[model samples]
Target: MTTATPYDAMFSGVIGQDYEMLKLLAPLAVEMSRLVGATVSQHPKTDDKPLSVVELGGGTGITTLSILAATDAIQLLSVDNEPVMQGQAQKKLQAWQAQGKLAFCLDDALSALQQLANGSVDVVASAYTLHNFTNGYRQQVISEIFRVLKPAGQFVNGDRYALDDIDQHTRTTQTEVGRYFRILTAANKLDLLEHWMVHLFSDESENHIMRESLALQQLAAAGFAGIHLSNRSEVNALVTAYKPR
Candidate 1:
């Protein structure tokens, strides 16, 4: 598991299908960047220069790679709990890190956030990972994101959130999420996500489920403002909320 091929643990052989999901997700992804940029650009500390960005839960580094490739980040750090995942990302972003343009860390998202100086980051990002935690833990993890972000920093994602009533005990719920959940009641994409989860757990009973409405409340509870649903497709939803300075 500690070997270089981290996506093996992060995807369970399923993330290879992610690029396909982008067809339904791209426009929303663009809006996400706009929201983040609008906020970061207004930072009192912001000059004409692009700000630093850190992608939490940056599994296999695809999302991090996109951000690194597309933006002018002063620094980019890829954080994940799995060393394999982080290692995979480190390899992808190594050339940038080699030039001191980016860095990667093998740590839980919250711990990685803790390693940064408070209010020092322009953006704290995660993709498809928040719903992986129970309600309480997710809140704690996100609050840590708040602590690390500069006054006008942003939290952005093309993440997958879940619906309630799945009867998964290890999960917590806030609101119902995703455009597809309301359609494929029985054969939800969780079935696909499970392909990615099989190596980590013994049963589906321990999986985390999300409800969108409740999640927004949780984000609000954490003192985030501008909660918005950016876009949607069959299974994934583009969403964002921000920490007010």
Candidate 2:
């Protein structure tokens, strides 16, 4: 049986090459530091204590490392379904963990969220993973997220762009689409590039492409307030919101 390749350089081909992803990622880190005052945990502490953080769908650990490098956060929990990706992440964060900095849990998103006690975390983060499921599953995942966050706790999602709605005909323009293509060209991985572009362009999976606005709205309806645009690049955006205290 053929399982999904966990180490997909194609993701960087799609999301990373977007000038917006690069630009917004830097500022988002600074903003996260300013907004969430949690420090990297030095000693073992219960979730009831202060400044706990859990990250869902962290693949290969690049973003996780970026967050740790940018902030003084503890109780770092990263979850993903792909073992190859998780292994890469574990290797990357091994040194920090040697000094007591990070940890990982391999599980599906909802189960991972459920494992955490309610109202325990200061911030919950997920990147680029929101756009992979159907609307119902997405809503269910968001509801679980709503349930886990501490009152006043923050959730920041470095996710997809708000594409054009069905009725109105507006989306990232051809030029922007070309930009995504250019990244693939530059990356020089033709086989992977062709596979992804074919799937993405052909609409092989409609439910997988989560509309950014609808996601924000759903999060809002789930009782998360203070929603705001945390990052934007061309068509992709990473939004943030909070569960009230």
Who wins the lDDT comparison?
Answer: 2
Clash count list over all predictions: 9, 9
Candidate 1 — which residues are off by over 4 angstroms?
A: 1-45, 48-50, 163-194, 197-207
lDDT string for model 2 (6-105, tens) is: 4433344333233233333234433433232222222224354435677777776756776676555455788887676677778779976676667788
Which residue pairs come into collision in candidate 2?
A: 20-233, 39-72, 39-73, 40-72, 40-73, 40-74, 41-74, 152-244, 152-245
Error of 2 at 132 (Å): 1.6
Give the TM-score of each candidate: 0.68, 0.74
* Candidate 1 lDDT tens digits, 71-176: 6546777777775556667766778888776777778877777788888877776666776676667778878887887776777766554434455422322112
Against the true structure, candidate 2 reaches a TM-score of 0.74
Candidate 1's C-alpha lDDT? 0.60
